[model samples]
Target: MTRRTPSTSHRRHQRGVSLFGLLFWAIVVGFFGYLAVVVFPTVNEYFTIKRAVDKIAAEAPATVPEVRAAFERQRAIEYSISSIGSNDLEITKENDRLVIGFAYEKEIPIVGPVYLLLKYEGRSGQ
Candidate 1:
């Protein structure tokens, strides 16, 4: 009986990623990182606005005008809020409880001539 040796071709093949594959992955990661950097502030601002609205809702104002005034006061104290105003709010009452609703859009520059538009909506109750 004769025994055959292992083929050299099997050993000659290389494994793992190539230089081009590495570069492509690097670019993909970089793009996501950039997107996060551009998007985080807008999300943060949305939360801040939500908090302010919640605070006003908790106050349970008796009138719509009072709600607007309270929001304006909060906005004045919060320098981060520039995209919203008293007129932007939708005020209503349910079960003798004040409900405030607001919606706004924020445009963030991702790159030259490229922008990301984020839509934010908030309600005081629930």
Candidate 2:
């Protein structure tokens, strides 16, 4: 029968995460997860707004008011686009093509006195 004791070299060469290291990584991952959970909805809304704008632009509304109204109607339907109002849309005609653009800021609170500010802007495809 042979009994083997852990050598100093083996102990020093051990590679693994300590409890503290694991905890630190867990906290970091958890924090990013929390941020993603908080930010995803706003990002979804941004995409929704972009889609609505693209649709409106493609439809080629006659007037700026018409574009704005179309966006309002879309907002009423989507319910996710609450960050910007119809008036916030920038309507312009580039080469006689209706281009709708918008920009808005979203503030997300992560913790006490800590907030994340996201600026979103997009223009409809011609």
Clashes of each: 0, 0
Work out the TM-score per prediction. 0.86, 0.90
Write the residue-wise lDDT of candidate 1 on 14-63 in tens digits.
79999999999999999999989888877887888899999999988888
lDDT (10s digit) by residue, model 2, range 1-126 = 666577623465669999999999999999999999999999999999999999999899888888888999999999899999998988888888888889999999989999999999999993
Regions of model 1 farther than 4 Å from truth:
1-9
Candidate topping TM-score: 2
Go through the candidates in order and give each one's C-alpha lDDT.
Answer: 0.88, 0.91
